[model samples]
Target: MTLTDVLDDWPLWGISKQPISANQISILEGGLTNRCYQLSLESGEYIIRISAANTAELGIDRNVEKTIHQLVSSLNFTSAIRYCDDENRYLIRDYIEGEVLSDNVEDMSHNTLSYMVEQLKALHQVPVEIDLPVVNISEKAEAYWQMLATQQPNNEILKMKPLMQVAMSEPPAGDFCLCHLDPVLANWLYTAEGLQLLDWEYAGLAHPLWDLAALFQGIKHSFQQLEKKSKKNSHSEIEQNLENKILTLYGVSDLVAWRRACMQMEYLSSLWYQAQAKKDSY
Candidate 1:
């Protein structure tokens, strides 16, 4: 709904105690699967994320997002959610103020990477009670493949689909913990208190390396995106030595295995983009 549409309903939507005359809201850009609006009122700043059409088909479980957000908030990793719609159409949360990390994605410093590794280590230690679904490359690739069954998938993507099965069958380096599968740079915010990761839509149980791998791949993707924006013809791959340092900081022993895990994440990321593109076409 447009801001005007939302304002027409006013307090009827239960946004705040203030009436429509007192309410102030503006759209926040960079939403991939939902529409986000920054709402300022007499109370405080909040973010209201309006769900997109057919979001469920993207394999996002709003219930899991609520559970993970609750835990992460207690750990001070993100702002607390103020409200979540009963039918999963929307959610309201504290609009955190900080430097959105996407602005620095292409030239992220070593210190930032180190800090992120430390936080990820703490996150991996969080206990998981429920049987959360695994967001492994094999499972997600297949699911996304089925979602795009009618559409013509890219030739490269078709070839990469079978490779995920091998990674899925291999024994993981460690047990599963809560993994944030989508650490895309846009969801990151560097705050004075600490690093704040927003958007827990893809949180699930998975190998710890999955998050690390996803981070590595996500960073590289940001660089590519920057190059594309400038219409550049060539771009170098993210330095393997830097990836090595990230693994070393994370205490990864099996370099070969980690590379394989990174490949799995790379494939899954592509499939996810393809699926989202297909969804948007509708």
Candidate 2:
């Protein structure tokens, strides 16, 4: 269906208007859960994102997303929501013109990791009350394991059960902040000024270190090349550099607490991927 047809029934516009004519470019083809389109317009491009595979069935709350977007926008950490159809879960956003950090971080020179950490720090600094319903780490893991039980008998879920146990046993020992729970490379755009975050579907109130750990896990393999290309730096040294940058930017004085948070996030990563895999199959 055309964008106009899909959004034709939206009540927010009240009066129906013709959809803006633009060349529709499909930028993200690999995302399993959402159908995202980049609409190139005469004035500027815009993004049109729609949930896939019945996100509502998988615990996605469009109303909660709307609230989170407003909260995050107030702090300037994410793009402002231009228009939303809460019932249909269609979103229109002003497209950001910048390179995705995946491409920009290829070489990783001159404190690029540090810059990202600082950017994340600025995002976490935004304090706001999150009334949104967010899936906790244990719930996320349980969903994955449940899917595994129904799909294939994979021992990986059994192996991860204990890890999840350890992670959820200890509650967050530090202050909670507004966190961008998902840190995919596509979610970040690097501009001349700084990094801009996109995609608020997974945002909520959580420990700040969650985002940091998620980013590290996502980019671990990709950043290896950056580590090799760096002058006089070992892989461990590069990893440490990234960690220090995150700590410094977030002003984290409790290293032990932060480390525990990162560990928890790593296990959550396993569950997230597992969940995505199940969603793709069925």
Give per-model TM-scores.
0.86, 0.80
lDDT of 2 by residue, 148-258 (tens): 565657655576676667566563577677778877676778776577877777777777778887777666645676667775345666665666666676677887777
- In angstroms, how far off is 216's CA in candidate 1? 0.5
Clashing pairs in 2: none
Task: Estimate, for each residue in 90-165, the C-alpha lDDT of model 1 and write its tens digit.
Answer: 7788889899888977667888888888888888998777666766556566767766764655445566555656
Candidate 2 Cα lDDT to native: 0.66
Clashes of each: 0, 0
Cα displacement (angstroms), candidate 2, residue 111, comes to: 4.1
In model 2, the runs with Cα more than 4 Å from the true position are 1-27, 30-32, 54-58, 133-135, 153-156, 159-163, 224-237
Clashes of 2: 0
The C-alpha stretches of model 1 lying farther than 4 A from their native spots are 1-15, 21-23, 153-171, 228-238
Model 1 TM-score relative to the real fold: 0.86
Number of the top lDDT candidate = 1
State how far residue 270 of model 2 sits from its true place (Å): 0.9
